[model samples]
Target: MTRFNALLLALLAVAVPLSLLAGRVWIDPFDPQLPNAAVIFIELRLPRAVLALVLGAGLGTAGAAMQGYLRNPLADPGLFGIAPGAALGAVLSFWTGWAASGWALPLFALIGAGGAMALLGLIAGRGGGVLLFTLAGMMIASLAGALMSLAISLSPTPFAMSEIVTWLMGALADRGWAEVWIAAPLTALGLAVLGLAGRSLDALSLGDLAARSLGVDPRRLQALMIAGIGLTVGASVAVAGIIGFVGLMVPHFVRPHTDGRPSALIVPSALAGALLLLVADCLCRVLPLQGELRLGIALSLLGAPFFLALLLRLKRELA
Candidate 1:
């Protein structure tokens, strides 16, 4: 398993740069204006590929952390309310014309995600148990989702509706280095926090009581994990506007190579996530559909059944 993980990581490292180059070369195929392609490469495809890699790594690592902390294999940042909350924030910002220019949407999204985490923290009722906390996560997500739906329903302008729907579905089409610059630092910080807490996550797998018995402070670790996941997913949702299932799916795919161990989960998951998103984005470009395929739609088509299988497996384990 370790060997497999190592090989996977190496392949991903090589593939990311190659994928960027491949995407650039493929963008305007059969064009006689090959000499002017440098501007296109520098201005468009390069940034898009970088965004995919960053978003994928952030989602993958955060998903691993969420699952570890909650002791639930099916956990995702969106399931815990962050994505919907962020979406509401972004869409509302756009709807109100408050952040009509630049990256104001993503900034508001981060604020919305933070607000959701804060609300959940308060709802957990001053150090609530795991089940109570998890329920709070669900409640907040549901509430945010409802609000987002209402906003969309009430939107009168076609342009606004189009923008809202496009972002919600998640696409890397027009993003550039500016978006990359905004997301990169936040992702790096989130990864650092996750790395620091890896041992704690490993302890958590043995159950709360056992973890405490072994000198692990489960509650504190859980708090840190939530903060980490919130920040990471918030940043991602800010930029990508809710690319789902990468979080849930990438970790599951990588778990085998890590032997189901949390301590070894982060890096492998990050690599697999980069691989998944790159391939997904590539497929989006090549699909025969009239409109561009959205990342969220692609992930849903690929991940929904996998999520169901995971649920069945969990039920079996519980039984």
Candidate 2:
């Protein structure tokens, strides 16, 4: 592991325990008199923390891979339409009252992600350029977003509308080992797939013709990106609603510490993403609000400013 990776790992070690102990009702790990400490730690906090780690790593790695693949510093995993597609699925679950079922929501979300992935591949076609691929993804995202809005507008009941809106805001409250089980293996497999495409991403960083000359197969790389991103981003939305920006912001935070190669950036970005999400979730738990803040809203509040700063920086550089 790189020093950056080691640093993130160390931070995570401290943060995980802190997250478990710090919540609306604080627990004293050392206090033998603390009631239900084990139950709180095991039944509630542990799974939520694990889910944060898994999903954050997935988003972070996806963001790094996306920026490298498109050669655009501003690129995000959501740009591929997979997230919106997944969100649409989750919204549909609410609209149809299936969200009350244990597995229906996630299953619908995964199916939506798969549909988006298939559509992206189909529309981009074999040998499509990066620009075409990106545009196709954007189109799908727009479509999915529209569909979700329509679903909300036509929701059969006020309760369904309320549920849909709240879920779209995103949070980790009440999640359990079941959610962790659903997301962990998928994210791990997605990470492995992205890692396999690392060398190709490095080559593509040099531009399309140059990468082709270097024997990087665009079709294969594209497939890997779609599959990897689909699984990671899909599983995340399936389990945790629509937590955003980890993928977009994480790579930028970690990139300066790395050698600036896409291959070298992935693992460190994953670690940093995990750390960022874990800490953010803890903050959400501890904040003295009417209720815990939504994880998606908190990140968007942080990321929108970060994104604006990047735009300003880019503008200055271009000028």
Please name the candidate that would achieve the greatest TM-score relative to the true structure. 2
* lDDT of candidate 2 over 51-135, digit per residue (tens): 9999999999999999999998999999999999999999998889999999999999999999999999999999858999999
> Global lDDT of each model?
0.81, 0.94
| Per-residue accuracy of model 1 over 240-264 as CA lDDT, tens digit each | 8889889898888888766687868
lDDT of 2: 0.94
- Where does candidate 2 clash, by residue pair? none
Count of clashes in candidate 1? 0
Per-model C-alpha RMSD: 2.6, 0.7
TM-score for each candidate, following the candidate numbering: 0.91, 0.99
Runs in model 2 with CA error above 4 Å?
none
For each candidate, how many residue pairs have backbone atoms clashing (under 3 Å)?
0, 0
Which candidate should be chosen as best, given lDDT against the real structure? 2
